[model samples]
Target: MKYLSLIIMILMSPSCSISKKNASVVKEKLIVTFSKGKCLGNCPVYDLYIYNNGRVVYNGIDNVKKKGVYETLIALDTVKRIEYLMKHFSPEEIGNTNGRDIPFTILKINDKKVVYRSTRSSGNLLKINNLIENIKDKL
Candidate 1:
């Protein structure tokens, strides 16, 4: 019975082996970051919105007053995938959750892999289309 349980665990482990041919067909999550622009009277922490194929999936804004508030907005096809990631990955601290531009970190990917933008990608914001194009072949 111990051996049987071990076998089940091994088989249930996450897999990240999507063939190049099928990578495009798989539903992958999209994580995008927006800049928390400079302040005038009160710094506006830009809102975070996750849109999949032009449809909104999750929308949350940060309400912090500090400048340079980084926020991550994640868009996945299913809530189960998001929950799985939230359980596995540790997220960054969000200065504000009610205003706009709440930064986020990748918690986990269901397939054990994800395609996201690098933090040092030129400007503060990373293009979603560019990220998708960069990881489409890898899935």
Candidate 2:
């Protein structure tokens, strides 16, 4: 009886909200940020922030087609992708040593931050980055 009561209490606690089966129903505020630093070569220098509320903010600093702040909304598919990443992908995968580069890329999802200096990136991370670049390019 005591073990059962303890298990019930744990499930009822606030900390269990995220890993629960109903996480999608109780979705938290999601914020994904991507920033790239300058390199000896002219690499794109900018910061991009994506929020679960469908708002996308991009700040183009230097070496890009555009140099300004831009904001827009993202598609529902993008939001779902981000939520999946935040829920499953480990920190090591984000900082995975695929290749090296002169510039550094910083990607932050909620509290986790991955800073990598790589010339190439693959997977959903790459797709999200491309989305940021496209948005900045049009502005």
Best by lDDT: 2
Q: Which stretches of candidate 2 lie over 4 Å from their true place?
A: 1-30, 91-101, 118-124, 127-139
What does the lDDT come to for candidate 1? Answer: 0.35
- With candidate 2 superimposed using the best TM-score fit, by how many Å does residue 25's alpha carbon deviate from the native? 21
Q: Return the TM-score for each candidate structure.
A: 0.22, 0.62
**Can you write out model 1's per-residue Cα lDDT over 22-128, one digit (the tens) per residue?**
67555534433222333334433343323333222222234443223233333444333433433444223112234233223332223333222233232211333
RMSD of each: 15.2, 10.4
Candidates in order have lDDT scores of 0.35, 0.71
lDDT by residue for model 2 over 1-139, one digit each (tens)?
9999999998787775456857764563547887989877788899887778777788889998768988888787777776675566444444455444578788788887767654455565566556656655665
10 residues in a row with least lDDT, candidate 1? 116-125
Q: Using alpha carbons, what is the TM-score of model 1?
A: 0.22
